[model samples]
Target: MEYTVVENSGYDREKDVFSHTSYWEAFSYRARHYTDSEIREMHVEIAIDLPDGTRTYEI
Candidate 1:
């Protein structure tokens, strides 16, 4: 399955602004699923910071 991080945040130091980068929740239904390692890599891929030990539902 493909991996996607729905909940996205952006920080604009020049403007000091942050907002939702995606319209879907990180763990919402109908959204793409991601592995633990992928989640960690995603933090850098998406340039969004995720809290330590983030987890997603699989059912």
Candidate 2:
């Protein structure tokens, strides 16, 4: 799965702005039983927040 920084990309709730939804949105509502391997097989990348406040992980 690939991620890009596009202008006007997906909504940022913390910023209170409405924007385009990314491909990941399709999987947002899935059950917790869904595994990372399953998601990867589905071409979805998981985003994680690192200890560094300025960093965001996309994998």
Q: In lDDT terms, which candidate is top?
A: 2
- Tell me the number of clashing residue pairs for each predicted model: 0, 0
Question: In TM-score terms, which candidate is top?
Answer: 1
lDDT (10s digit) by residue, model 1, range 1-59: 23233322232322212223352442442224555665464431222333463433231
Which parts of model 2 are misplaced by more than 4 Å?
1-9, 14-30, 33-45
Q: Report per-prediction Cα RMSD to one decimal.
A: 11.3, 11.2
lDDT of 2: 0.34
**Candidate 2, after superposition: displacement of residue 47 in Å?**
2.2
For candidate 2, lDDT tens digit of each residue in 1-59? 32222222233432211112453542443324346675454433334334363324344
**Candidate 1 segments whose C-alpha is farther than 4 A from its true place:** 1-4, 7-25, 28-32, 44-59
